[model samples]
Target: MSDPHYLREAEKYESPIPSREHILSFIQKRPKSKRQLFELLSIEDEQKKAFERRLRAMVRDKQLSCNKNGVYRPFSNRGLISGTVIANPKGFGFVSLDKGGKDLRLSSQQMKLVFHGDKVKVRLLNRKLDAEIVQVTQTVKTLVGRLNINQDECYVVVDDRRIKHEIDIVELIEGCADNQVVVVEVLNSPTLEKNASGRITSIIGNYLDEGVEVDSAIHRHEIPAIFGDKALEESAKLPNKVLTKDKKGRVDITHLELVTIDGEDSRDFDDAVYAIPSKNGWKLMVAIADVSHYVKEGSQLDAESLERGNSVYFPHRVVPMLPESISNGLCSLNPELERLCMVCEMEIDSLGSLLEYKFYSAVMLSHARLTYTEVNEMLENKKSKLRKKYKKIENNIDFLYGLYQTLRISRQKRGVMDFDRIESQILFDDQGKIENIVARKRNDAHRLIEECMLMANQAAAKYLQKENEDFLYRVHPKPTPEKVEITRQFLTAIDLRLDGGLEPESSDFAKLLKNASGREDENIIKTVVLRTMKQATYTPNNEGHFGLAFEDYAHFTSPIRRYPDLLVHRAIKRALSNKHRERSNKMVELGAHLSMTERRADDASRDVEQWLKCEYMRDKVGECFNGVISGVAGFGLFVELTEIFVEGLISVRDLKEDYFIYDDVHHQLKGQRGGRIYRLGDLIKVKVASVNLDDRKIEFVPVSK
Candidate 1:
């Protein structure tokens, strides 16, 4: 049956229903039969049904609703729905409704008035999940970046690229400049036509400056590097040394001849090792700075540490997790001063199998702060100055070196794969300019510390696993079939193939690396193989780490900087006190957040490194260097330089000989004009054609004969 069309023949009556509101009002007063409704609407019987259908649709759409009897009433559920905005870098966003059912797909046009992390109220037009942003509820904090100035007002461009709105500044702040990054408090949000207004609270600094590393670290982790006065004052109250009362009934290993080994300029010595040969195997003790002893839970310092999650480190500076009073003094395992520590005592056999392990809270004193260079020199030449100065601690250092060699062999036997990836350490001159990019080499001493830490972490993981406790687990899942196939193809091209089928174990990977060690394609194959594996992430579930081939794994040794390690310490303490069974939901939540923040820190560090590297090469444009094809894309191929660890792209258009097509199955580019093929790991010479600081990108042109 056809429904009544209210618009049709409406002009015939003098005082007909004036509008939809009037018609709705007329129908609300009394119950109207179909015949009466037709007369009221002034329409034919067929048209009456159409009018009824239209009324029903309006009610269902929340535009209108029918009363219990027969009359119509306007929907009462009106105003707005509040939600959080999750935006993508592509400008589009999704308003995850707080009232909660399904998310509304907010287009870039609708989101033009909003920014990420903003609370918004949107009037839903349809139930199809695709809704427009009718209005914004509340604006959250805006990310700080460079502010663009105009005649009367200025716009504050956000550091977060996902934000599309520019906030207007009333007047110039004290330290804000053209390219300098600053945090602007959003006073007003821009709509379709209006602009956002903001006031500068803090100036980060010139983004191009070396000091910006701290700014990037803080901003990236969403942590406040600058501590509040109250927090700093609270940190000042901490004691300079462990009190005698706290050391009662605890093992005082202060005179154990322990030595700290780290970089030359490291301030906080969190870990110090002492080792000696035993009849059973080796007696190794790893003593970590007990920050927990000083920074008690729920204290100001502890709260701030929880907020920061972890310490952020750049090349030149480290934003310590705790105040310098603790990290560098009281809590630091400095020599002469007795410090509290959570020590891990372990017994290991000659083949690197741990026989027994014990954890304890104790008082320890470091005998000396030994730098890697000093120890390496002492090992290389016994007659060196360092060997003469620290002659007493030479036995312990030698024992540690022997243990590290044995541990490395054990790790290799267990099929642990280590990719020898090259990393550049940027050296800065007196003017805060990059003097040179030095490729960092892995040395025996470095590996020694790493192996010791790895052993401690493994022991921690095993302890947690045996306890059947719920803790933050470091897990790395296996590779995907597609990635495995790709790796296979690349390996086959390099005249090497896995003995097993597509699904090879960690041992297979280790053997492959060992077979290709010192070969031309070693680095390239390592890079590709690494890409095939999944990223290591922290989860509550106990899936083992595939890369390390560990049945269990958790970070334990570096509590000063890593939150996971702190949690592990807490877990260990609870287990020791027999209170580990009482679990808190909040701790688990904190672990997840900490893990996410750690990843964010790593990404931010990488971004700044790329920027600095590009800035370092800004003056060296047109210089040529030998490189290898690291990656191939549709647009270009990425080349990593041999001398300097800089990576740049070789655009396809620059290969002017012929048109090239990316061969996906083979992982190469085939040229049609000259039958030339460029595959992964192909060594080539490239010239630095240009550098784009805006995007932190570099362009390279292939150097041809």
Candidate 2:
């Protein structure tokens, strides 16, 4: 008696809701033809299949949009495409259209019609894969991470490893417990079946506390790390030093004895240097720390330093990109006192080339903050104390160690690769735990302050490309030929080749790391030509850098802690004063979303420092370590170890003396019954066996026979 075809299609449709306008006026017309929408509302073909089930349940609850050649349309005649969801770790998500091309995918059951940073309209259902979603609109929320709980329910999970969804946790905040992390907030969001309801909003700790690996790496890189009260009242109106009347007309360079160098328990000095011995030879200088002139450019301390696009550091703490009344007191360059910087001033020659450059705006004075083990004991010991503490910068740190041996011989005659990888550095202790890992030794004052910050970031990328400026740069490029034929079939099964061919040149991977220098398979073929290079981002264009070959590069020496080196210090103060400043198209869409959230905060701080170095070797589980076969794939092999540099895995069902398989052109794994192989620089031994830390993974095995 009721569904008389929605009462004869509500008596032939006309009440465009007229009880004195009860508002539902979405009228750019269009909607008629599911049989011409039940025969233009005239219903009755046996109540026209209940008036096509009340107009396909008002176009599946979005009140209207039947667009896949099924006509009907009307949600104010739809058409608005702003994308970015890409979900597939199956809670179904796919949007990626911020106006580029194609990319639409959708389907967590046709995206129960949209969630996950939603701002959709998507019409082309499939004009040969132009796929789309959110017919009208929904998810404008749901993304705050790290939860997992589990007692009276919990899940929230998303530290955006590309939105792989977990979501669920329905309201709870009493210091939420089980693996205690927290910070949820979502509230109803999934798509194929009820899930996305959250709450907890920050408990952030307990799972391995005490700076819980820096509050779980600033809550898995959502990175804000406290500082609002209008960014600590605009960092309490800045100023802590730099004065002599704000250094009367800039550039004093404090008698250019600039020093700094870093890391011996670094505390924010943000670059400094100085060189000398010129006349067809060396001048150098550098400087830095002006942090976009006390963090300006849309303040609340530049919106908490653009929501932390930099300064994370982790193992034991340092979230800071700004607060410490400006990154450790009015932008630290700390030492003698008056700071302010920005410099550069080059002019090298003894073949480190450059021979000219400028840039200015200064007022420096660091003169000794030294470290990298006291400039590698004053350049490999000349009876150290950095030569009786400075003695007027010991002939400018020995002409900056002969301009870092003429910029490591014009960076190995312009090819560069030298990847003797093994970095390490964990240590910790006084209650923060991890007491030792080691490796970090790069001496000669860390290659003379890394060749004077790569000659002041290739002279600030050729001084902002001779003023045709637009910023960011840094690049890297050159790897793919399928990762150089998977690094030439894993260095031709260790016989090792890399002698310029098969696209080699980075000085033929620096002459195959100087012929595998002092081998032990030299960290297994320099971690296999560093997993065949290319990962140095930040772009505005100039590609160059293939591991520092540099036609131009940038990161103008740190700008306190990198937001693309404070947009290369406001594009080197608008190209040293031609000053147009304009910028904002939402600052080039937030400089490509802060360079993809600083490469997802450096891959979630190297995945929580490889899950806290596999929970600091989970009490050395069954020992055995030597390791190597660093990855082969058909579901397992990986390994790595060699004195606690952890890495785990193995699992080709524990390679129990047979059935191995996965060769894919010899990156290894062979065995199908004792043809025994394993590959990627073999060396095996394994042992660790288990440490998931909720799938940050680790597990090894094969030591038996």
Candidate 3:
């Protein structure tokens, strides 16, 4: 026999008399109790049960809310706002509003029924910014966590620390062991009385296994690790080499000497450059791989590429946007191989100003594949064996160096701010464990290539804007007044000042950075300025880039790795074909999604790096190292070790001296009794106290000298 509840639900679906829309419309007109609604609609005894079921469904969907007096009304009529909940590690949560305001605070008790990333309607409580969840509109379906089995009972603890609830496993898969990472599919959501339940669908591996830390981050961020069958099939069908027919409309520049310069371990080559002295100044050609020539729009490969947005580069691993067949094989500009490309040819005057430029499809052959180290060595040692060996293209390299110097002068004149921060590179052993961490160095060759790319990107952006083509712009807004004020106060504390009125330009920042160079507090000042600036994003609306001091900017290089570059190529192609295309609203949506994916990749990579660093520091407990104060907060100071480039927190409680007070305006902590000060960029000595692998954190304590 069927249950009465199931029968009633089935009956409601069959009959269309009291539809969801009808009930919503009726309640929206005016608030009414169930009896009033039933009487107003002239419901008979038999229809009463069906009407009640429909109303209940409406309430569950968050279309309506029922008051304690049994009165029903539209949710919007009662000041309820819908938002996505962001859970905190401490069991509380915040609801991020869609309209973009301050996040509404949710108490721990109010967050018990909902999971992280759940969409819910919330109503303001007595507090101005505090809210309580009225109803959940959507729930998370799956999560990645570590499995724990106690006797006959099993549960999975989610990797996201903010989600404080452990999912009770109802049906466990075979061979699942304790402390193993696994993916859980939610079977039932939590109620007022019970916790959420789930089933283990897949086991990743033991938490301590080699490369498992990165794997866990991949799952935690829900990054697509493998391509779909259709996408792979499409990639497999791509040609290994450019066909004769494919070069029909392309200008042949293979006779010109072009070279590719990248890192020693780089496998994918997306750009090649050529330079020569012209009558007026210099003629520069930048050839980028034509990825869109092979991957057509609306295809499976395009779909997958758009979803990935950009390649995520880890220390030794790379999750490429496109498959190797396309990114590294067919589209890569390998040496001595004829490849199709989109070229940006520019004529620059003696002042390094771009006088004129043109874009065209071209076929080119890379004469030599060089590394930054080799190029820098050749430039530094003119008469070296390596320079003599590559003498055929030595003149072109010299010309590039001259052009780079000119462009750098122009860039400085434009007041571009450059931060000289050190980035650490991780080295691994044969067993895939961390061996050491070293600083990655950048030289003139790197800057020369960057200037060339920037010129090409600017040309593309200007050309597209003139053609009135719809495309994405790389926009970076200036810092807000509040942030600027904070920066001003911090600079004053360091005995420096930032001019340029309320809205200072990039050149002003450049001057201040110049003044701070070689000072004891250079790194601290740079960090503060960088923090004050807003993050750059992609948008259809052109707001200009604040960091580079460019009036217009768009990503036009490395289409093999970035989807925005691919879209720029497509837009350029459309404009070349003389097609009058209007901007579609879909492009706006795509810009937002691509920006989100970019941030997602950054967060995942940072998580993996932190985990690996923690692992590297695990064996060095109690070892003392000289470090610099990288950050200061109310809780403690963050120190970055000088030798290993590892960072760890020195908690305030661990000071064990005079009580310290945090000075937010000065970005420092001062002892109330002893008057001891610990400011940013101060040299200090610290000892590693502990490492928590589960939390991906390192703790340190001050070492008395």
Candidate 4:
């Protein structure tokens, strides 16, 4: 059944009266007042109201707009721009321009008609940097939120903190209750006079359910959770084991003592490593799962994998890029099983410099499955029980460790910045509640595997560069002048100095970090220096990576999880086949899309972690703890508690003794009357005031000394 409003809109051209097209044409030809339109159409007194209604509808639909002169003109005539709305939680928003100019700000009143992530066209008002939404081209259709029921009245509060509006629920699904997490499908978009309305589509779980937070985040970010039917069907056709035909043109290295080293909980293994000491250097072989072999270009499986871009990992579960039949079955490099892989064989000198390398398709057997903990134990103590259990392959592990040390020396010599920051790991009880949060320690085994993968990736990138082929290079741009100057001022204020000029090299940042090491404020200084750099992204332009200090770099080791790595695999295969392939025409668009998906995964993971942290802190509201001042703003100080590493804000209003003023240059807050100052890295005691799960925020207040 077609909607009546859509029917009216569709048949607008067939109307006997002045059709919408005719009205737009007339307005575009010459701007006219409402009175002028009425007179020009020669309408009778009885038809005046109908004509006025049509004009109003046209304006509401954004087909036409009214200027300050009280004259109507077609919206397409001139001076209109289209962009995506980025709504703020404060009931205002900014439109990121499609043509790359300053973002135009929209007032709270103007924001009432649109939701976050909507696409709209706007006309700049006479006021500077402000615009009014002329039409909504696209509306947010599905949202993940929590339901709030008041007897017969209900509304869904959106999960995105930036979207301040609540959607009125016109219909409800069975078994849904108040404070339940749900997925809502918008039925009617908001207008200036009324809030948007939706119907609950699916109840994920109760708000406090064990895994509901991650489930909500998955839906909220719109990460592709389920594979399409065609993709799954395609995956089903793949063989369960590698056959002789599959390895026809591949090298057989089944005798090599290669092992897969991963976390204890990891199920899918994508890489296997083997190294041996040579006369002049070491011979390193890095075998990566050949995902490109099973999933061909333009296939349904390939399309779905590209859509996912990369696998999203939560602490409890994983949303894989490919179906389980492929990602965990055929593509995983399991131990003692013959698997297809792409091997990078490199010859490195004693100084850890890559002498040469070659890439080829191969059939390899992983000798054993190893864990980082066991490997670290073996390397640290040769007589350990686990070391004796795996003594048959211990020599190969030692060779890899030696290669890692050499590589570490080379990395240090190259002046690559390595920040030693603490990463937290959550331990869950049998009931799925967090038992504790502890800092994860990275051992030599982790660095060994990392250095091996780095060597393979660098070799692959250099191979493509030598052939002058177009491929996606992982590019990290230099910091801007403004950021560098700000960093310089901050360091100077801390009695330190940055040696490099305006455009400092990565080595300069490395030197500054070395100087700040072991100080009480080391973590704070490292964080600030990291903030002064740009995020690394994928591009075909071949800009060097500044942080890794690599002239040519690409992600070529994780094809089982990352789409760009799959593309790299395909490019390398083409090169091996003596066919120099050109870059895909959609490379730029694909790069941008992949970057967005990466950010989406990061944001969703962060959101879930924050929600879990907030839930964990809910019970300790009145407890006091020592913390460091991590951030300062006009509103308050952000303190990260030392005991649990949780951060909360101490609002300025709670500082009742004096009025606080923010000092931006020095990154501190000062009390006007009390003369007390709180700056970054200052240790203080704070009492937890409140926890708001809806906003994912924790509040704190200073404890009187």
Candidate 5:
């Protein structure tokens, strides 16, 4: 039968035709003439013209071959490929192939055919570095955009900057106003002849709205912020509080002095810790909320969490992976409340070497909920007021710090790469507008919690590796040769060496960071070294973690927020029960999907942060401030201001004093006349010249230093 994906093909085109897949499948048996295909696939007289276009397009894309007799067969060439289009804001894009290889670049002209995140089949050009779109198999159905009214015409400017086309709106919703933000339901994608068209589905108000940025970002990133009916129903069915039945066959640790240390503003507590001096060194118990117990693999909540991949944390809002009923209630380890948890108990030596570890299901009551500031103050001063106020867990905090000191030694010995970059905390005014931006300092208490989590994650990874289960490990591959060489050039230009010839170990990077300590350019040096390494991703293969310097690593903490951690929990539970499941095929797809969702969340969060920062700086035009060069490019320098953590750009054209030449190899700008050089990490003075809220851009001009 010459049938295709009838519903899908019908949705994609005005007139349905036999899909490339279906035609190819039919032709696999034997070559077919046009008349035979028309008769077999039931192509009518009116559809023949449209079907001919598809066939010709397929032949041009190298998906099929047509002989002198007009007979068609599958194309034997390997030039054809399928992948997702990752578009850039500059009107160009690249195809990230399904079978991994170098991404094929598409020119701006070719990009007009498809939107960002659309799945398409492409044909590699003769140069091999570029590709042309053969067909858009899947188009983005909905997009977030701002309504633009140009005289008699109305269109939507997509919030996702990568999608360059403005979708035309033939009909407007009743309340549509000029410059309003809206969600567009895509009707048809753009062709070479015309622009994209859509219908206004959601109205988010003006861009200046205090909370519209978050909503727009959620839609642009396709983040599932609203819970589906099925998911909500499932969540509502869950117990409001941990029931006695939930603790069956679990160890009772209610008497233990377990406490949670987190940011003061945090609501959902995923992990609680208790440490005691043991026979060898110390016994540390890390109790994580048992989210997997409630979010079963086949449940709607599980599907929702898997789709979300992880919690998306914006400045003040959070799109939690699990609903509030679970993430902030039953699965949350609140103080003085009994909660069911999966516990990782570890026995470490005085040198912070893991002697032994065990995992079990447990019911525990947190003795106290302590903030990081309070814990740090209590540890720094034995006679502090906060210490007296939290007297119940004072000794418990001491035990945790002692173990932290030992773990610090272990971290240094293992050559862990530490990138202590400045983190910004964005504040909002009473009216919900951005008030200020400030650096969020990391204290010893923060480090203590991080070390504890690291230890627990390592224990989990070791257990999974030993159990020989098909589980996801947080893997960090070695740096690419191109990035390493660029980093080496940058470091050498500053009279520093990265030590490693081509493939450097984490210890080599640690040495470079240690050498740059206390230098004026320390922050940028750390940033450069950090950029040289590849992004860490989850994989079924245990390729090890480079940043943490661990041979076996998996995300085992914060299961309530991260889907991978929940999966790890399930794998551990299954192993403990001596059950074997054959699903290695699914793990690879799962890892890739989780990685993509994580990236999507990060990009969405970053976009919201940028929008807020731009809003914060909108009124500061003409104000002068000191800034350090954080990023460099052919266009200009990205400068982060001193007191305020906001970033602005100093365009090359604004450098009127000199005709500067950008040296991408060494990441610097050299004056064509005066021999002056500007490099990343260099401190400079600049005045904010302009701020464009629509483009989310800030321009700066150099001020006399």
Candidate 6:
């Protein structure tokens, strides 16, 4: 027992204590404590940690188990892996592993025993990591969906398509009818032998009601919408206008002539900026609304804000993170009104290098609430009426523009990657229906504001890092090796090369974009490169941002809308006031939750927008339109209409007269016999073939000239 497999373990690890095989075999008949195992294995003080680690490895690999009392035994479910089931709408699923790796694939039959979002333990069914659900550790308690009644039977067709099962309606809500949306409480979860069942808890409304799509998505994503009673009461007692008492212990920057630049229909303005020429370079100040000052720690408002994570914006309405009294009233940096703000003041050199920076609480007066169009016109067109009207602050605007240009040069030199992607704006009619979808163009004013915010964010990150405080940073990790390789293959086929070898820097990506500047497939190249990048997330660990090429970065602006920004504000205040005090221990958990909620908001918004787009295109079946191949996959090509901005799929099966082979690396489908390639960024004419509102999909067919 003491020496079995000892030589093999020694070969695999240096200073090996005990082999996993020996540990598992020793505890097979009876559970043993760590002390007993240590004594039995004759482990020295130096080898004690190694022996404990071997036990943990055995537990992780499902060879042994450790209970709450610190006793270990042979694992009952030896080969099962714990994970969360992520089911697809096509009757397949994947188990997102708890320890993290490639997901285990689950086929239709294997997925029958569990639903989407179920915490489960699975056993590997094949060598390909295909798995079968052995047991469900947790099941979803309720589902939001449309109630369907067929003659004598009833079921709920879930709003989340990823949940492929229709819950049998064993109990129904009174007055609920066909095609009505409702929430169903799960009375029974599916098993290998029995189907899932639920009872209707609440009836929302008719499926065709105006704006029901947004409402359904809100419930489907479990977004916190209504404020709690306590939070509302607290918000009601707050002052609508800035009070003199609130101005205490704050610097008065009311004479700075700061301006708030935003979209025409924007609300809840959170940041204002002003700049002036300095001896060396320029002095820039970014004042963000002090949201944390009003929402105190452990207060009701803070709890509500944490639950929301961030504000969810829709085309017609917004689900604010804080109550209206805070987000839109007291904290909004409205023009002609004094407001409390946390100011980031930076001293820089002529080349836009930061020399020093400081943060302080201040009272600011926004002289003008400017729109991007107005500012752009003011700078470019001196003869415009708007330019002459806002002439009082013309000098301030000029200085800010100068600062932006300098910062932009520094950014380029630092190898910041810029993706030239087109974003669509939905134009609504008087009745709130989408009239048309058009591309949105970004002008210099947009980049001007972005640069200022980026500077402030980076400064805050550096300050906190230097002070050694615990907080969240906006982090973007480098692209994976697999993605980099795929991008390399695609770049090579186009006669382009990605430098920096396996671990390419952002400069390499910038160089590729610059080389592709005048080409027809420029946007497509940008798109491919963009897809190769990973999504930026929040983390307590400062890994830096790859996209912006910043050495330190945190989201310091938009505290009224984002929770992490609020957290940053609190951390900064704490660091400035008491350097010796420790930061909150919940930063890690908050980072993960805030990141997840941000994604949740984005997905919910996208879901509603896609549904509306489907409705808009429903009447245009058989109409011919020109589109660009925006995406390519094995099943089909996603084509975005040039004028309308709607996207539809051209199925591979519809390509008659030849068999098409998909090349994912090149993002193209090549016809075997005809030798024609349809790839990303290729222009083509198509006709709307069909529309599926339930699936939020539009189908297209190729058209000949």
Task: State the weakest 10-residue window (summed lDDT) of model 1.
Answer: 13-22
Residue pairs in candidate 4 whose N, alpha carbon or C atoms collide under 3 angstroms: none
lDDT of each: 0.78, 0.72, 0.88, 0.87, 0.89, 0.88
Ranking by lDDT: 5, 6, 3, 4, 1, 2
lDDT of candidate model 4 versus the reference: 0.87
lDDT tens digits by residue: candidate 3, 1-705: 122354455575664345566666678878888889877767678888877877767765667777545778886646678999999877889999987778988889888888999898887542246677878888888888899999867898888867878899998888999999999998887777988999998888998898777777777787887999999999898889999999999999999889999999899999999999898789999999999899999999999999999998877788899999888999999999999999999998888888999999999999899999999998898887988888888887899998999888889988989886677889999999999999988999999999999999989999999998988988899999899998998888889999987799999999999999998768778888999899998898889989989998999988999999999999999998898589889889989998988998998998888889999999999999999999999999999898888899999999888899999988899999999999888999999999987777899999988
What TM-score, to 2 decimals, does candidate 6 have?
Answer: 0.88
Each prediction's total of clashing residue pairs, residues at least 3 apart in sequence or on different chains, is: 11, 4, 0, 0, 0, 0
Q: Model 4 TM-score?
A: 0.89
Clashing pairs in 6: none
Runs of candidate 1 exceeding 4 Å displacement:
1-140, 150-153, 160-167, 174-177, 188-197, 206-210, 468-470, 499-503
Clashing pairs in 2: 33-36, 33-37, 87-93, 183-202
> Per-residue lDDT for 353-447 in model 2, tens only?
79788987888888788777877777777887658877777777878888899888888888787775787778878887788877776777787
Question: How far off is residue 321 in model 6, in Å?
Answer: 1.0
Task: List model 6 lDDT by residue over 596-684, tens digit each.
Answer: 99999999999998988999999999999999998999998999898888999999998775799999878899999999899888899
**What is the TM-score of each predicted model, taking all chains together?**
0.82, 0.32, 0.88, 0.89, 0.88, 0.88
Worst 10 residues of 6 by lDDT: 123-132
- Give residue 380's error in model 6 in angstroms: 1.6
lDDT tens digits, residue span 139-200, model 5: 99999888998787999988877888889997778888988999999999899999999999
Candidate 1 lDDT by residue in tens digits, 1-705: 232543553665443333455555665666454446666657654555556666656655665544324544455545467899988877898888776777877888877888887888765544345455656677876466776665665777666656767777865667667777777777877778887787888777776766774584466347657788878988887777788888976788988988899987788889989999999879999998877667777877777887777887777777778788878888777877788888889999999988888889889989989888878887778688887799889899889988888888789878988886777898989988889998887677887898898788888888877776656777888887788888888777778876557678899888888888888768887888898998787776778888988888888888788767777887777777678654457756776777766776676777777878989899999999999898988787999998888999999999887899988766788998788988878899999999986556899998896
> 474 in model 5: Cα distance from truth in Å?
1.1
> Is candidate 1 or 3 superior in lDDT?
3
